[model samples]
Target chain A: AQSVTQLDSQVPVFEEAPVELRCNYSSSVSVYLFWYVQYPNQGLQLLLKYLSGSTLVKGINGFEAEFNKSQTSFHLRKPSVHISDTAEYFCAVSPRAGAGTALIFGKGTTLSVSS
Target chain B: DTGVTQSPTHLIKTRGQQVTLRCSPISGHKSVSWYQQVLGQGPQFIFQYYEKEERGRGNFPDRFSARQFPNYSSELNVNALLLGDSALYLCASGPGNKDTEAFFGQGTRLTVV
Candidate 1:
């Protein structure tokens, strides 16, 4: 079984400020990582994913995450953020070998941006 | 193109009653998955179906049952519902390929009283 932990339950930042949402996972084998964003009353949208290869994986909306194998972390970051970026962020992990496996998600981190 | 769509955006049911939720996957998608999202918590996997066959299920009880149709539509039925079952039911559709991305629907909010 695999689980994901999001260190921050909520993050508040001013517009144009940089932000980092921390995530960690515990797995015995290789895993695929994903970051999903959920706006108010909406379904989740994929922000980025880390399947393999380069440590730094960039995603849509200027978001990026670095897969740190040693630390077991896949933290999401953005150099500068807009108010539109305010939403709930979830971290998820799926087993690499387990085909048809369901993604395990973290509780989530609420990102609130104020102008 | 249409994304995943779940019907009955909001539903209210009494304890011990039964409820059924529906989902229509995107065109060409072959895999449909169901999840429950309790307030203040992330969604939990419930079941997955591919090609109209059960493929995977999470640590849920038998009271939660689901089936997929040949057209890739799906229905999730909950028998003997409990108040604890109150949550948002989400449906997701994927290409059923290892490399394709999975898309989610807005979800059906179920309130059990």
Candidate 2:
């Protein structure tokens, strides 16, 4: 089984400032990592995913995440923020060897960006 | 080119009643998965169907059931609805592979009163 933990429940940042959302996971087997963002009253949108190869992966909306195997962490980062970036961010994992690709998600972090 | 689409953007039901939510996957996708997201919480897996077969199930009770049609569309049914059943029901679709990313729908908001 795999589980994700988002360290912060809420993160506040001013517009154009950098922000980071921390995520950690524990899994007995190798797994896939993902970051998703949800706007108000909407479903999740894939920000990025770490499948293999590059540890530093870039995603939409100028967001990126680094996969650290040694730390069992995948933290999301954005160099500059906008008010529109305020939303609920979630970290998720899925077993690479499992037949069902059900995603196990963390509680989520609310990113509130203010101008 | 259509993304995953779910029906009845919002619903209200009384306790002990039954509710059914629908989803249509992207073209050529064969797998559909259901998830429940309570307010301020991440989505929890409910079920997954591939090629009309039940591929995976979460820890939800038997009152929560789902099925996929031959065309790859799916429906999620919840019986004996409770206040806890009121949530945002999300449907995601992928190509039935581990390497691919799943696309999500707009989601159906269920309000059990």
Candidate 3:
């Protein structure tokens, strides 16, 4: 069994400010990591993923995340954010071996950016 | 290409009643997975079907069942609904390949009263 823990329930930032959302996971086997964004009343959209190589993965909208194997963490980072970036962010994990495996998601972090 | 599509964006059902939710995968996708997202929480995996076969299931009870058709479309059925079942039901599709990610639909919001 695998589980995801998102350390923050909400994050507030001013426009053009930096932000970081923390995520950690516990799985006995190898896994793939992902970050998704959800807007009000909408489904999730993929922001980025860490499948195999390159611990530092960059995503759309100038967002990036670093996969730390030792720390068992994948933290999303953005140097500057806009009001449009205000949305719910979810961290998810899937097993590497099963092509049909289901994704396990974190509780989600609400990112609120004010201008 | 059309992404995953779900039917009846919103539904309301009474206790002990049965409700079915439908999903159509992307043209080339062969796998469909179902999840339930409750308010203020993350999405929970319900079931996954690949190539018309059941591949995985989560911790949900047997009251929840699902199947995939030959065309890779799917239906999730819940029997004896409870208020706890009220949530957003999401359907996702993938190529059934180990190297790719799944695409999601807007989801069907089910309210059980």
- DockQ, all models: 0.62, 0.69, 0.66
Candidate 1 accuracy as TM-score: 0.97
Off by over 4 Å in 3: B97-100
lDDT of 2 by residue, B1-113 (tens): 89999999999999999999999999999999999999989999999998899989999999999999999999999999999999999999998744257999999999999
In DockQ terms, which candidate is top? 2
The Cα error of candidate 2 at residue A17, in Å, is 0.6
Error of 2 at B45 (Å): 0.4
Model 2 C-alpha lDDT per residue in residues A1-115, reported as the tens digit of each score: 8899999999999999999999999999999999999999888999999999999999999999999999999999999999999999999999888687789999999999999
lDDT of all predictions, in order shown?
A: 0.92, 0.94, 0.93
All models, RMSD in angstroms? 1.1, 0.9, 1.1
- For model 2, which pairs clash? none
Model 2 - which docking category? medium
lDDT of 1 by residue, B18-85 (tens): 99999999999999989899998999999988888887889999999999888999999999999999
Candidate 2 deviant stretches above 4 angstroms = none
Best by lDDT: 2
Q: How far is A60's C-alpha from truth in model 2 (Å)?
A: 0.6
Which is better, 2 or 3, measured by TM-score? Answer: 2
